[model samples]
Every structure is written in C-alpha cells, then in structure tokens.
Target: MSRNPRILVTGATGRLGRLLVPRLLARGAHVRALTREAGRAASLAADGAEVVVGDLGDGASLRHAFHGASHLFLLSPISPELAAEQIAAIAAAKAAGVQRIVKLSGSHWTIEPPGRSLSGDAHAHIEAALRASGIAHQVLRPNAWLQVTLARLAGELAAGDVLHAPPAFPKVAGIDARDIADVAAHALLGPEPSATDSPWVLTGARAVDHHEIARIASALSGRRIVAEPLSREALAQRAAQAESPYVAQVHAQFAALIGTGEAATVTDTVERVLGRPARTIEAFVAEALAA
Candidate 1:
C-alpha cells in the first residue's frame, strides 16, 4: 500500500499558492506548505497542510521542509535574486529525493535570448537547473494576469466615468488567476508530466485590448467610460518604483514589443488540461466588476 504523495508548496501563502493549496487539499493530497513567515501561515495549517517555516535563501530550512515530500510546487515573487533563490530550491529538492516539481514560469512570449529580459532570464536559469537535476517537472507559462492587469481598471471606473489610461495596441489574452491555479494543481496532483510536454503555455480564450476592456466595463457597470493615455512621466515613475527592479526592466521589454503582436497567441492548454474552455475575458471582467 502506497502512501499519498507528500507535496511541498513554496510561497504557499501567496496569491497563486493560497489558491492552489485548497485545490490540492480538496483532493485529499498530503501537503506541506513552506513559508518564510510562520505567523502568516496559520490559515494553511488550519486547512490541513503541515505548515513549515523555510527560506529559499536558507538551505537548511528548505531541506527540512522538503524532507519526505514526493512533489514540489515552486513559486516566488519577482526579484533580482529570483534566479539564485529558485535554483537553490531545485538543488534542495534533488537532495531531499522529491520526485516531481511544478514551476510557475514566466510567460513564453516574454522570454527572449539570454540577457533580453531580467525575469525571463531568471526563469530560464531556474528551468535549466530543473532539467539538470533529473527530476520530473512541469513548467507553466501563463500570460498577463487579469488580477494584475485588468482588475485595477474596475476600481478606477468606480472612482469616475473616464478611465485615465491609454488605449493600448497590444491584444493580450489575459487569464484569470483561478485558471492558473487550476492548471498548476493538475500538474502537481495528476499524472507525471512527460519531458516532451513539460512546459505548458497558458492564456485566455481570446485577445483583448484596453479599448475593449473599457467597452466591456461600460456595459457591465452601466457607466460611459473613455480610455485616455496617462502621462509618460507617470508611467515611468510607476515602473521606476516597482518592487522588483528586475520585473520593472522586463516589463519595459514587454512594452517595447507591444505593437508587434508578438504576445497574442491563445492556447487551448487550460481547456485540454482541465477538459473545459479556458475562462473568457467577459467572465474575468464580470468577476472584477463584482469584486
């Protein structure tokens, strides 16, 4: 009789990890959630995860958390140290004999040749470590998130009629974070991922621009909102003050290719993996407005 897979989830208290822990828990998997802050993970412990305090930068703590775990869910916030930290996690997982890893990776379109984008380069480095470790792993490459890219627009609409934002040209297939969580759960708890199909590129059902976003918001909220570009100085300031300068620089790279239509590819990965249509833009907007 085999025991249930003991999965270790890093960043378990974060946006995607918090959502994923519940999905794995609902399926009766044995889960160990790793957090740097012990005080913030009580909810995870209450949900039946063996909450353990561990830091990616602190190897001893990571090994202690990884002990006896059969699988790993790897995620972290954007930072200049992202590459080194996740690379360390991969090594720790290998030493602890963890059999599988599911890594939420940078979007595929955002990656270029080495040194092109800081975050992209970071993901690339961590992925290389995963491959070298000879562990079974799946990498999920999700596109623009509705939570980050579009949810704020709803709040701005609530404040006034006119949306103080430029009508962007790029058609982004922004995905709901819930969809991302769902796909990641499948990778972690479902059948082992094949190396040939190791990396999954995920996006929404259709592409939409800021103008379409404004149009949808108008219809949903019953308010006539117009899209207007913010000042260059304002945009630059926001990027400059971004929490992770690495992320800020990578976003600038993404901004440079906005009009080239390089990131508009929509995939059926979520549908094929989950056996349903990927959640649509309208659904995302409806939920955003409701929130």
Candidate 2:
C-alpha cells in the first residue's frame, strides 16, 4: 500500500464512519466519502474528504464512487438488504481495482448457526462474498457497542438510579465504537497486509453484566444506580413502547444470544492490532457522562 492511499469510506455519516474519516485524514490519507445524502456529508467535505453522493442499491453509482480508490472501508447500516448491498459494493470495488478492503462485521458471528440473528446472518453472507472475491481483506468483528447499550438505559438513569433490562442477560465486554475505528485505521494504513480471510474479534478489557454496568455508571455519574432485572414479558412491553414492533423482535433475538452467554467471549485482538489496551466500560461511562 502507498503511504497516501486513496481511500473510499462508505457510510461516512454514520457513527463509526464519522470517527474513522477524521482519523484517516489525520494520517495524510486521501479520503473519498460515499454517502446517500451529499448534504449530510458537508462536515466530511469540510474536513478534506471528497464527499460523493451514491447509493448502494445503484450499481453505477457504486462503481463511480469506487473509481480511483486503492483502499475501501466498507460499512453499512443493518437491514434485510445489507448482505446484497455489501456484495454489490464488493463487486464494484474489485472492478475498480481497489487493493484492500476492511469490513466492519459482528462479534460471535462465526459461532452463530444459520438463522440465529438477522444482522449476524447478513454479515456472515457478506464475509463469504468478500472471501470469494479474492481481495486482500480484513474484518473487524466488534462486540455489542457500549454506547448503544448505554443509550437504552439513558432515560432510566436520568429519571432515577435504576437500570432495568431482561433478567439473566449475560455478561458482555462491550467495546466502544471509537476503539473499533482506531483498529480499522491501523488495518487500513499499516504496511503489513492483514492475513487474508482472517477476522479480528474486538472486546472491552473484561466482561460485565448489567449490574456491573449500573455500578460503573453510578460511580461516573455521581449517582447510586442499581440494576433492576425484568421479566421477558416486561422487556417485551418496554421494547414495544420504545421502538417499532419489528425492531423489538430483532432486539429480543440479540438479547437471547446474551442470555445464552455467547456474547461474553473476549479477545485481545484490539490490543494486538492497535498496540494498546482496549477501552473499558468504566472509562467509556466517565467520558460519555462528561460529554
């Protein structure tokens, strides 16, 4: 890879992509951001990224976006069409002669049986397609994002000192999205190419259940927070009131994985890739509360 590879970053306006674009720019990489809405990409454009309007559904547009790009950071939102869109993007990338691809995948996906989780299945399909494409690729499979998990309890935390969730939710070493982005930047820019068809499973320093998360949040927020376990029916009611019925069903499936303790497995992949310890829940809580 060249010192200043022309990198194409998809989903630039999303959480991880927003963090990633700036980091890539800081390293003197020439970044081209692909977004569905050009207007939303203004900040990226202001930050020296060549923002291009494109849609994953449009093959011609994807080809245009991939043009002249040596490296591709492939990220997409979770949807039923996710696998199809990523496969399309992979084809475009290969056609454009892109040298490397770093894909954002999901943790425990390899262990998941078919039809376990919709999102996991979609990502697994995409990973298979990438391998078949024969591109030099690296996959970052991160555990449940700490920010998303905390956001679910934000209202409860603000109203009182109790954090509630379904009972028997297993421990998970949830990782910060920023840490995932940092590892991605390293993989995209590092001289040694990542092992082909290999994936890096990222996690926090240690696994913790909701009780531990509550304690950590309380310590950081200067409040005495306690964990309140709820029944499956109660959790269903809460999910129904909070989001669409379909989304609630999806959440239930993921919660089932946690209930089974599958999401708690930890790996030292982040430290191995970034040469630094992964961020902890305590630190994430402190920074989030401060912000």
Using TM-score, give the best candidate's number. Answer: 1
Model 1 poorest ten-residue lDDT run: 161-170
lDDT of 1 by residue, 138-252 (tens): 9998987878776467677667766555325577887888999999899988888877666799998888877787798889888786777768887888788776766787777
Q: Which segments of candidate 1 are over 4 A away from where they belong?
A: 1-3, 112-114
- Candidate 1 C-alpha error for residue 68, in Å: 1.0
Which ranges in model 2 have alpha carbons more than 4 Å from their true place?
Answer: 153-155, 194-197, 220-222, 230-234, 241-248
What are the models' TM-scores? 0.93, 0.91
- In model 1, how large is the Cα lDDT of residue 192? 87
TM-score of 1: 0.93
lDDT of each: 0.83, 0.84
| Model 2 per-residue lDDT tens digits across residues 32-119 | 9999999999999999999988999999999899989999999998776788999999999999999999999867643367788877
Q: Model 1 has how many clashing residue pairs?
A: 2
